[model samples]
Target: MKEFNNKELEIVKYIKEYLPFREKHIISTRELSIEIAEKYNIDTEKTSIAALCHDLGKRYKDDEMRKIIFDNDNIEYPKHITGALLHARVSSIIAEKEFNITDKEILNAIESHTVGHANMSMLEKIIYAADYLEPTRKLETAERIREKIFIDFDKAFLEVVLESITFVLSKNQYLSDKTIELYNSLVVN
Candidate 1:
């Protein structure tokens, strides 16, 4: 792993971050975070910070996530899958406003961790895919999904989108346009 800048070092308190990410995934955070840094040849510190805070917004209740998105963006969220879809953006805003986290790399990774984007940075892709495929995930095809994180990220994203589609279809829920676009785009990719 690469060395950390002082600013980067300050961002991750090390001990606190180690458990939240590790505990949730059932993979020791230090081990998993280091694996990402080593596999991607990135600074472990930055990876540590990004992995640590990737799900900060998920800590907000579904209602709170909606409230944050609603108040910050002037867009009222209807009841649906939007809270999870929108949390990435809302969390990035909080990272900046509340946490004093302004590193665009970190913020973007946090914001785009849900609903994979068209042109993701390596860090963004890593965080997004890691959060989804983390070992603790127990979705039907989770192991299959984990296999595609690097081998074919597009497929992994397609699976994520497709799962969301199936879920909405099952419940007769309204689908977000972004979800529709993503689903169609992945179908062609």
Candidate 2:
């Protein structure tokens, strides 16, 4: 378990209340966030908060998460994106409305952790890396990325994005336009 400031503790309490079953995973992300933030000299508090709240929407049933997307007029829930990914958008919303997180970086990190986005900030990249490299993730590639993270953040991030796209293709699932857009922007730019 990682130590949290009083403010971060509030966020943790909120997460625990919403995601009791996912405590182990959530804590793992938080600890990873702290490690990444410290290595990068970024704000660990914000990174931890973003990581803690990243999967809050996963607590909802698939149908419920879809309802959240359906109910939001601003979000265009394409049929291509799965319910598992939809939780990122919903979790960002919950982080703001339910947890009163005003930081856009934290919100964007939470929203973009699943599919990622173009032109990610340092904080966003840290949370994304932490989410992907958390200790519980058994993927051998995760260890590779973890090793490369300190040496070269962007390269590792690009690899993570590519791997996720590959996984989706392997499953014969539709890839979101946002994911494609992110890949193109990163690779071409």
Best by TM-score: 2
Clashing pairs in 1: none
Candidates in order: C-alpha RMSD to true structure:
4.5, 1.9
lDDT by residue (tens digit), candidate 1, 1-189: 345456445434432453344345523333454565566576666666676666556556778878887788787866766666766776677667756877888888787666655556767666765675566666666567766654665667567557656877798877666556656655664
TM-score for each of the candidates:
0.66, 0.90
Question: Which 10 consecutive residues of model 1 have the lowest summed lDDT?
Answer: 22-31
C-alpha positional error of residue 149 in candidate 1 after TM-score superposition, expressed in Å: 2.8
| The best candidate in terms of lDDT | 2
lDDT of each: 0.63, 0.82
lDDT of 2 at 13: 84
- In order of listing, the candidates' clash counts read 0, 0
What is the C-alpha lDDT profile of model 2 across 45-105, one tens digit per residue? 7888898889989888877888887787456666656667888988988888877889998
Question: Once all C-alphas are superposed, what RMSD does model 1 give against the true structure?
Answer: 4.5
